[model samples]
Target: MKHALNNPYITRNFNPNNWMSDIPIIDSLSLAELVLPGAHNAGVDKKASYTALGISHWAACQNNSFYYQLTHGARALDLRLEYAVGGDGVGTFWFQHNGFRSSRSLESLIMSVIRFLDENPDEFIILDFHQLNPGNQRFDYKEFNRLLLTHLGNRLIPSTHVFLTLGQLKQASHARRVMVAAENHTELDSTYFCEYIEHEWSGIGTASVSELNVHITKVMKFPPGGSLPWSLSATSYNVAEGPVNIREHLDRWFDPALSDWVLNSNIINADFFETSNLVRHCRTANLIKANNH
Candidate 1:
């Protein structure tokens, strides 16, 4: 059953490039209180030719590049990385999805974000390193942190001051537009990295939209106020059921109740995000929250 697409928030006037700045009320809200559209496995995309150890179709979550995703209203990015130790490209980091690794280096993706921030200074971005190739190989946290600081520089919003309003946060870092979140690592400097954003995975790989909705509703029950930011994984994984099919299922379930879904979750992350209405819904939810408060 498909839901009605009469959402008032789904508008043509919303500027994805400057979505946050476009909505003046958004600047006054705290980061924790805002609804952000995020890309799951954000770095794993098919825009460029990629070399994968596993099936690319099953692993690739996005079709656009990092810059495209951000310019299209995605504020949060869920990244998975693996460091190459014994290859020709030793010491360089690569974006990965399970066993599938992109031909693109982690630096390339970071540069993409940096470019977006440069173009849209008022826009805030969240970069969550959800996985760092733990247990499979010896990862270098120290070097990794160094790499981040080098590229990100003063652009990173420090962990000490992440609860401030969007305008306040930009001012705190002297107009910085990005925040980096990694797992609890002692080696990671708290001055640069904030607490890693947690996630509630639905853990289902079914074609049934009803099955997916059960998990989405359960996740919506989570209380909003918290020190650490979190995300709801709004995706279903079925190798046989490709992203096109998954996109249809998501649209059917989320379109009618888009506002409700956005209001309940901090980060509404999904695969094939470009094909979904999450960004528009998030923008509308932010406006709704601004008016209520």
Candidate 2:
């Protein structure tokens, strides 16, 4: 199962809690794969199946009523494929899959989006990377910067900014700021780069962004703890004017539906897959932010 993950940066054994336990933890990657019923599946009569399909479709649609209600009438989703590699492969996109069920669940959503981008390789999508944590003496900024430049740079169209959450970055680093790495490290200072979105895209010989009808997601939130969201910052591509204090507000921010995120023991974490009520709140908050913008 681990071999199936094609990501070079993340492998099976990338464990941060090695000292505490010996069990291998799966990477928190969003890979796309789904279990759609096959035509050969047992129990259904083919003649009746096709005849009843139209009614089934409507029934199913009605069953998933939350989709229309939540999206405010926007049914079909638009994906903004942001490629990660130069061959026009890895990237992110935005789509409206109705709700967080089946294919739209977080894991399935990630997988489907990537699959769409992978299959449509010629359409050089936009690309960008953001630092997940605050850059301080604590992180290996130099190495991460190098990796970004080598792997993800030049591929991401210009003016596509990467977000770095410096909410906890204090100027002083009296403690040791050792950036340990099993494989990679990078850092960049005073780095600001931009170019025409197409200049870099043309290198891949793909369809124009306009032709693809790619609609960018106005807001992308990478809440701390990487779950539904315990703490939220303006993690969008755009930065704000004043300072944002994530710790103070997010430390104990509570909602009851969050219990669904609880993982089993050291095996999982609170809001691990982000299914709890907290996720709903976060998505709502994100929509609000998008509207405000």
Candidate 3:
């Protein structure tokens, strides 16, 4: 006798109800709403240029996006990669680890992250890998992460996409579905690959850009979609607050190549962080820190 089996939770075709707490943009925004490319604003309109101004990504290592924008001309991509290489970065990938009980497998971590992402879809997620000590047992999680990334090209809605800043992913490659990578300048590796974009980031919230430190990064956006994101969750806040020493911690994003290019990029847009309500971003970043390891 045999029985049929399905994935425990009954995977669907990524129904919004499965993960999205907010209404889908298809329901919220009309096709006409996000249109771009007026007659006057011209650089070089290639066919691949994303004409629609849709989808926004937020992260620490933002300068990566700045570089990408210079090379690639796409309108729909909005990248916010934050380079927070300020952790012990010990073991193997503390720069992206979740500190997961100090003794968990990558599978467990992936499951935890998946569940977390599913449960809280509104919040911008940072799957912090600054604490992982990958070994024989935990290598599965790393592989699973790549698998999930590959699937996202097919899975993500026009509204839902993952934002990432990789302190270390050895050889990452993904499907062409990836729209933007707001990461630092690096050789396109097998492990970490995305259509990089350029964004002007003040490099704030890092160890060097804290209140205690003179350096400051400004918010180009706030509270994620103008409301306190429900999915950004408690754990997300924990990670934002975990770093004790800001300056020493900033050393992680301290790539000489990245810093040099950032100093010479044309990604300066002051409008994103110029609102009175911008304090919400700090609140949110701190909250994310508080919730993570």
TM-score of each: 0.89, 0.21, 0.26
What is the lDDT of every predicted structure here?
Answer: 0.76, 0.21, 0.24
lDDT of 3 by residue, 1-293 (tens): 11122322222333221221122221222111211101101111121122133211111211122213222221222211112222564232111212111122233323433443344433222221211233323433334345446544332222222232111110122212222232332332324333232222333333323332222222212322311111110001113443222223222222122232111111222112211111222222222222331
Which rank order by lDDT, best down to worst?
A: 1, 3, 2
Model 3 regions lying over 4 Å from their true place: 1-101, 121-192, 195-212, 217-242, 245-293
Tens-digit lDDT track of model 2 for 44-107: 1111122232332211111122122112211112111111222454322111111111112223
> Mind giving the per-residue lDDT tens digits that candidate 1 earns over 1-293?
22243435445577788889877777778778888888988888877556644466777788878988999888999999887765554576778877677766778877888888888888888898999984245788988998888888678887877888887886666557787899888889899798878887767654355666787877767645685578878776665844433666555444535336667678878887867766776787777777666
What's the ranking of the predictions by TM-score, best on top? 1, 3, 2
RMSD of each: 3.5, 23.4, 20.6
lDDT of 3 at 104: 24
- Stretches of candidate 1 off by over 4 Å are 1-12, 52-54, 134-137, 205-208, 241-245, 248-259
**How many backbone overlaps does candidate 2 show?**
19
Query: How many clashing residue pairs, candidate 3?
Result: 56
Candidate 2, poorest ten consecutive residues by summed lDDT:
30-39
Which candidate number has the best lDDT? Answer: 1
Error of 2 at 165 (Å): 17
